[model samples]
Target: MSSSSAEVLLVRTGAAATLDRTSVGGRGTVASALVKTPRLGAVSVGELGFQGDVQADLEVHGGPAKAVLVYSDEHYDDWVAELGRDLRGTGLGENLRIRGLTERDVCPGDRIAVGSALFRVSAPRRPCYKLALAHGIRDLSARVQRSGRTGFYLAVDRPGEVRAGDRIAIIEHAPHRISAFEVNRVINLDKRDVDGARRVLTAAADLPPRWVAKLRRRVDGAVESDASDTARLYGTD
Candidate 1:
């Protein structure tokens, strides 16, 4: 999709973000909403069967919308963050549509302008099991690795109100040469059993070398056994 065609719009929140999970797949609108968090930025999904209602808000933070982790890639259906693309315009159940934009085009720490609303890419989206079955998409986990279009985690850069049909523009917020996806890809290439969990470990394990040390211990122990390090990292023991 072309950058000029890039757009971000706001739809009502059908669900809320979990305090524990930045994003979640559920049956209906979230019963609870954060009292303080803004709901406009959250990415809400209707029942997780794929190609269904999906929305991204343009304003506010702290509520469920701010919590949604999102991503896009041009190589695939782009359902990674967009619901309409997967449905093939069968009519996007999505509350909002991002046109001509997917995870591949966004850069980490980049600020996106959707009218008066602004959002920054916080991190990369992790593939969950439900996304696989809901969309009936095969090799999704692997696709993330090969495509490098892994969707992004968003943080509210500027809080404001947004609505559908709003044009969105991406603004660079960081001078860093590496993107979160690039770092993840490098780590995935070097390590085995590298999934979302492992990616987090590799990305953050550096904060506390002791944590990395602890992982080293667990990884070594798993290697001695029949299990792979990735399995142990995921607590598959």
Candidate 2:
């Protein structure tokens, strides 16, 4: 698939239930699988999420701006090599597994048409301990953060049915032109990049509020401790 026309490789959904493992701190039950089950055919995309999908924790997962989670199939090889295992069943808790698009190629507010639904890139997926728990690798979340391959979230603009093999056609690219990868790099990898943080913060309306707030503090030269915030954002608290 070309950059302009990516294809949905798979569709997945999961129920809201108790996680098989405890939180990273081992203090409480982290009520999320972060592992979606594949769907064989077309599925309805609603304003919040897929028809059968349910987030274990709404505080961090699903919402209007985070209606859907998207990951590229292009990253599978890298992850396979990094993890040294097959990730066929591990959907990374993403709703759509697509091809051709990655963090570097997609930007906040970019619009796309998938099947009959319309979606806009909202923000980058912040790596969390749930990823490590899902993959059985204690450092996977940190590795993902460093790699900048952390996928992205999409806000549903028009609800419709979508399926595997559906072409994802670009509708409108955001004027700001800040790729999700750049935002992740500034926030997670290089907090000292004040200029980059400023650009990201300016696009506040297109990013997650939590990220916008954090970036605001960084750009303002305030000492913002994100360790606890990150943990809370991922519901590992």
Candidate 3:
């Protein structure tokens, strides 16, 4: 597939596993292994998530709104340069390592098809403490958010099979043009931009409820800073 034509560069799935307590902010012995195993061929995609994939914490991760986490192959080089290491095969806790589409190109509510499975872009993936735990980097989550290189989540619209080489085509573009990159920036970095927050919360009808709640808090002056609730929910702290 052409670079402009979105494609699944890799298909990955994780087993139910635990985290070690030694990692910073580790949720000792939890039942999730966000790190995924790259599948060699086709794999089934479901509404909850990919086959064999399990999320440790449901309060923050793994739901209909975030059934499939997607990361761009485009960001791998940047991550290597920044972290001074290779991150391939890490899955980045994402079900699909994709090419062609980045946060800037996709928006909430956009519909896409990968092989036979269909998905709707639900929201941007909020980097939490789990990210730091997964990579053994103390400040990776903050760095990812600041760089606006965070990936996105996809809500499964139609269950089917997806392979590594499957073409990911945009079947429907969202009417609202608020990209996932903008959403991440507004929520994680620019909490003071009341106008921007209002635009995202009001214009993006399909924005995830948790994000909507957070943005509403920001718009209403309920939150005084950029401290997010994700750490509390996932026990990243």
Estimate the Cα RMSD of every predicted model relative to the unseen true structure.
10.0, 2.3, 2.6
Ranking by TM-score: 2, 3, 1
Candidate 1 Cα errors over 4 Å, as ranges: 9-12, 16-66, 71-97, 137-139, 187-237
The regions of model 2 sitting more than 4 angstroms off are 22-28, 229-237
Give candidate 1's whole-model lDDT: 0.42
Alpha-carbon shift of residue 222 in model 1 (angstroms): 13
Candidate whose lDDT is highest: 2
- Tens digits of per-residue lDDT, candidate 3, 1-237, equal 333488888888888676554576454655566778888877988899888888878887888888999999989888889888877756478889998989999889989988899999998887776666666776777777789888999999999999998888887888878889999888777878989999897645888676788788878887654334445324542
- For candidate 3, the per-residue lDDT at 68 reads 93
lDDT of 1 by residue, 1-237 (tens): 655676554343344332222133323332222211123543323222112222322332223323334433243355435434453321112233455666546555566765565676655543332233233343444455455655555555555655556676766645553355654453343334334334445434222243345335545543234244333122110
Candidate 3: misplaced stretches above 4 Å? 1-4, 25-30, 224-237
Sort the candidates on lDDT, descending order.
2, 3, 1
**Candidate 2: minimum summed lDDT over ten consecutive residues — where?**
19-28
lDDT of 2 by residue, 1-237 (tens): 456678999899888666534534454556784777889888999899899888887776788888899998878789889878866576577889999888898889999899999999988888777777676666667777889889999999999999999988878988888999998898787888889898887678888777889888887887567676467334443
Looking at model 3, residue 13 earns an lDDT score of 87
Residue 126, candidate 3: C-alpha displacement in angstroms: 1.0
